[model samples]
Target chain A: MTEKLRIVQMGLGPIGNKVTQYLAERPNLEIVGAIDTDPAKVGQDVGVLAGLAPLGVIVTADIDAALGGGRADVVVLTTASSMAKVHDQLLRILPYGVSVVSSCEELSYPWQTQPELAASIDRAAKKSNAAVLATGVNPGFLMDFLPAAMTGVCRKVRKVTVERIQDATFRRIPFQKKIGAGLTVEEFYKKVEEGVLRHVGLTESMHLIAARLGWQLDKTEDIITPIIAERRVTTDSMVIEAGNVLGVQQLGRGIMGGEEVISLVFRAAIGEPGARDRIVIDGEPAIDSCINGGVNGDVATCAILVNAIPVVAKARPGLRTMADIEPITCW
Target chain B: MTEKLRIVQMGLGPIGNKVTQYLAERPNLEIVGAIDTDPAKVGQDVGVLAGLAPLGVIVTADIDAALGGGRADVVVLTTASSMAKVHDQLLRILPYGVSVVSSCEELSYPWQTQPELAASIDRAAKKSNAAVLATGVNPGFLMDFLPAAMTGVCRKVRKVTVERIQDATFRRIPFQKKIGAGLTVEEFYKKVEEGVLRHVGLTESMHLIAARLGWQLDKTEDIITPIIAERRVTTDSMVIEAGNVLGVQQLGRGIMGGEEVISLVFRAAIGEPGARDRIVIDGEPAIDSCINGGVNGDVATCAILVNAIPVVAKARPGLRTMADIEPITCW
Candidate 1:
């Protein structure tokens, strides 16, 4: 595996940059090329685009040409949720038998909800005789890995809850817009009515959890809050309006029997941020796990993806979300 | 369509009594009998048991006799969340073709999260040639009905969010316990860890919305906060302990896509109780609707339910939750 694992990076954004930084340290991994929709960075080096100075590798808007370079082995995805739109690019490269590992949050919770995309990715990957693995640190590990860790002491393990509260303004601009900051109550209400301004990523967090538990989530409910701080507050340097906020807190749960639910709680805030999470299990070997920063949701997610690379590479050639990947002993 | 609908009132909890009171005033409905788990209530008048004085109806725990009496056409359920146990009574009579309406919160969201329970109810109802309609004025109607009603104005419905807040101590004690009042942070942690203390009805709330739009939900999550008054906070002649909370605020959400979520936010707090809701959509048509209340949530819930009765009775039923029922014309 150390024979230079040539990688292709897509979606020139924050997490994409982080992925590049982490993979740069790996002796076996080599980023062969990169692609993005932004015209400003098209002819620049991948490292320069990632803000880590310049690497010899050039960025290209032409996805086909990037794949046509023919040096790439695996496509490392950081594309947005609609990464599904890159299906044609995925197909073109998969025929060349290039496997994939992406930062697409949707991959963690793929099977039960995103059946269409999962099926498409699988079909394309199999046709090319390569595997596709998707993941991230938040929905990938923070929501999933920690809960999976709790099962060690839990015997009947009924439910697990994960909460993530982050300042979206500091992480990315799109997220700030996604949370609808600066919008009046009426404007926020309008977006929820149309279903457009709703924040993304957490759904996959819940999906990762349910799939890890091997259940089809019989029922689920949520509340996306665009709360107006009755008392004005600020996070970092952003002065969030006293009555308007982009902060979002949501809950996702899976019920198994009668009224017993396997639950997960998620909250992401742009203005005032405090992070916390807890998970409980019942009936024999009842267990509870709590963490202030939510059990390494960040660094561990990167690890999860890197670790999965080996497992996915050896698996059957097809599109595989975290669910399709069998559990491997990290030890 | 009423023809003096004969109904059996089962359970005499706070919610049960409210339904009984509602039934008392409706000239088109007749309370044939009442059932309680407590033997002390047996042979007592329902009005007395319901705190409304004698109304000529006897309260009995004989579930079999109530179904066998053949005097009622529908079973108004107000039992615990364990409907599998309470549903037995409905099934015994279901074979005789009697319909049901209940405050069984999970029933509204069961098909997605609790398919087993939903399927069983559907099967029993089908065998009996009857219908099962489960609702709550708050969890069912307020959380589900209002958002669905506004969907008419949404062009591409991306997300839906609902928030409900009420003072439970002023409303009911069980709700306070259910929300984790009168406990330390450790105790609250214990309950949430055991999968017993978190919000129960939000999953149904998500299912209600999903069923309405024919959207498949992959994730549902929750966040529960135990509210306690500390150091001589006086409210209406009550001095509460620092850790002895009176209610809880729970937020639950469901994500349809990575960025699109249908969220339900609920609060049952005696400490500081008020509700303000706002929704955000990315489409052309959007909205903002909110209600402030000095009374218990049940008061508003009852109104929401009464408004939806016509919609439920007229609609086709296969395990109907609020979202399955047509939008309430006015609330």
Candidate 2:
């Protein structure tokens, strides 16, 4: 533990590059290898690709080439959103006995939603004696884990409610487009039908909250609707005429005994006013907490992935949740 | 794990009684025994003493009788505030192989300040294969652990600042007097010299934050001053003159490389305006968070003690800090 910890960066996407940038600044960490399936990313210096000075380490598509030396202590994974998609990538890395901190949304709490895959991953991680954790700003921290942690000061929690409102004007182009920032009402519904418009992790966040509170929810529901533009909204990239869709309004509910005990509301709009994050816990000594101006989503996801490295490195070998590992902090 | 968890209530003070009341409401727990040193409380039923119906469990002065049956899984200890005072009680209970969740403040993070005592407790607990944790609202949750947890979304934290302000008018009489609500300037200075009218755990909280961030601090300092009343302040208990002391303002600092990196300010005064808890993390993607109308001190301490029961029960056999165990939630 006296020596600098070695790390491998996998997936050269937006979030992955941000994680690499943060990891590069840490004096206690050394980037030993980089992996990306993109042909353009392969053979390029990871540091330069992430908008930093070249570090002489080239990105390769082969997992073995990056992990073969067995010098890497942990892997920063930012590959996919679904557990099924990242299943093989996890299996490939867990055998190397290197802990992983991933940004996969569903993997944040996959045990309830994808039990079989989670169990398999757990078994594989146990066999290799390596820990795996999936975390990000939304599912990993803000909506679920933070609210659950807040209950530590409560005697009996009757209900938990959270709201995340984001102003999408300054977000990345990809994020803005993903949220349907400038779309017609009809097109938004069509995209929703195609199952690609809404945000991931609301259901996962709900389950994580329930698990932390020891609540047995009878059922869960997620509703996605459009936040119609009342006036013309303009961003750096595009403009939305009045009566068009500005962004999305997503509401997720966790029910027990036909009562909605947990409610999470997410809103991201180009002209959204009062961007903030709020949590209200109805219990003895009730709490009303707010993070003014909200947490920056993209930047925070990178931070969560980077800060969780040491926690995963020391965690017991298993498929872990944010609740399973030690509390994460800035490194 | 299938059977109900048996619990022993130790130290029948205000907090201890509140813990007992909360534990009695849970269907998954059973009150197995109770222990107290007060002569009048020694022969009383635990439930009745806590302002609840009789549960047939009498309070005993002997620790052996409360923990001897081998059925008790955890002990809810609401005893002294200092490590030296509670050292014997911890040693006596750890040997019984029953886990303990205590409200002792200094035990929250004793590694840096009280290394020998912490090591002794760790050794004793390890020998008996039992886990011990110290937690409450201030040292345990709000100041140290909450700030650390908030940094999970931060990339590089330059500074950590926390403020806990309370309005003493609604608080208990003991709490009001503890903060020197009606003391004059002369009396306040005398009490300060006597070292009796100050808060504990601020230094411990600073150290815990430093440990979580992996900062090697150069030195630490704590200062206490009085907040004088500009206008006569009145409370249910008493009234203070315009020039009299309203309450004490305590500040704790963690300095690194001659820079103040961690600062904690605590204020509890009668008629304090805008009581709140606020934390600011100066770093990449800086965060400013607040709990509107600060968390209640006494009630929250009771909640933290009861909520941490399941976490300690499953932790590894040793003296555990809030950072070592799983994230606590309402359970």
Candidate 3:
């Protein structure tokens, strides 16, 4: 008989619930606890909240109550995209000697942008002998880890470019709204100014690639633009006329030696006919790779978080990134 | 200033020479010693043999002279395809507390085929506190590691298939000849009977995928067939007429519960117009990935071996597979 890994599901959001459902399907994994700050979800059964039959694990707002029992080997954290918001939760979990696999975007590679906080987390994890990681489909795997792994087949790498073009029609309603689908051009600009229309983690992905390739960059830059629907575009819940905004195009560049050596382009719109994920490497033995249809973001996010559990459990104590551990696989 | 990692180049074959060239290009890597059993290569400067400026390191025939100096941090070994042939060399190198990254095919996942010998090597590595790995373009990356990494994006995986189609026209003369590019069907059958016509790593790659996916395969089968030329095909060294053998097609299958769940198809021939590397995963979120041009086997073999030095140098002591350490990246 195989031993089941005990894990706590943090943040009972869509991604968290999906991860719970996946854990339920695996006989080698057991969900022992759940956490959420929402008052209404505090006392609900975790499995029931995830749309599965009750597993008898209750959700709690108290982190200590969920993790302090010493039964949790790992925590699946899907709270927020920013490190500033998730830092406190990580600090509380580390001292319990529980490893964490988070979906926090900025925490994916926070060394450059949040060096002090990263070091602090590293210190806490080391003190308690726990491991911490942040990963997802885009920033964690597609743009950073995938390109870095492809470079293993090249003798010399001059430049690397990755593009993610997604069709947002079948995505969750929240995701469709998050990409600024069916907005006027003027409104799109206003939302960009408010910092709500753009995607996070492009810059983090750039830095992760640079760190793995041993490149010292002069600076990193991100540019966001609106992709307007030229014709009538209809989605699951909305309709946009010609010249209206459909989604956003985000580009991130890492400039080194006065040249952009790493470029990541993300385009998400409602009616993208040729949705795909592509990577191009310019060097000796050049590589041109493509995924015909882009990876499903919400589903993949849940999968990567679950897949990282075993890897994180045995990792050396510290703040770890996707590049710091072995390539994640479904187990 | 960053301290350089000292590496000893062993084997002095085509792949070894290419690895030496790549190592010379990196400022963070230094060639400390070179070893070869060939009389013609012994005493020759490794860099000159690799078609580069002389690096002032002479190739020696004795392994002790190359690794016994205690200056080598790792060894780029490109000696043989079988673990049985390289087991002694590994035993000799591990006791020096020096890590090894070989191009041996069977060593990629030897636990299934050579369990007792693999145990011996593992024990030696642990006793000496050194890490040992075997990797290349086929068994190590494209068929095994690449697909396994892609599965990180899947919620559930039902089947996996990888195909490598190569055009032998631009390859080295030796590789063209080895694929039996200009042989009759009868000659090809004779070579197959002698165990010289089929690719060596299909079964190893199958086991690697099975291990990563946590699948218990009942058995695996490899089938080899000649790809006969329908039209005249010409290469730099030879020409083949219609009805003659142009190359080979090799298929490897992994059966689980009496069903074929893993399939790898490798086809290499002259005048192959659509040469590419592709992977298809059948599951909840289907992934159809393709590399427009197949990864050049020889060059990639060299690149992966050299790129693994720094990673192997810092890994924990044991017999490691591609799944055991962080993914290899050019640094």
Candidate 1 regions exceeding 4 Å error are: A1-331, B167-178, B194-196, B227-232, B237-246, B277-282, B302-314, B327-331
Superior candidate under lDDT, 1 versus 3: 3
| lDDT by residue for model 2 (B253-307), tens | 9999999999999999888888999999998789999998999887799888888
Backbone steric clashes in candidate 2, count: 0
Tens-digit lDDT track of model 1 for B163-192: 666655454556666777666677877888
Error of 2 at B2 (Å): 3.3
Clashing residue pairs in candidate 3 (N, C-alpha, C atoms within 3 angstroms) = none
DockQ, candidate no. 3:
0.84
lDDT: worst 10-residue window of model 3 chain A: A1-10
- Score residue B317 of candidate 3 by CA lDDT: 87
Per-residue alpha-carbon lDDT of candidate 2 for residues A7-105, written as tens digits (9 for 90 to 100):
999998988898889999988889999999999899999999999999888999999989987889999988889799888899899999999999999
- lDDT, candidate 3, residue A323? 83
Top-down DockQ ranking? 2, 3, 1
Model 3, CA-based lDDT:
0.90
DockQ of each: 0.01, 0.87, 0.84
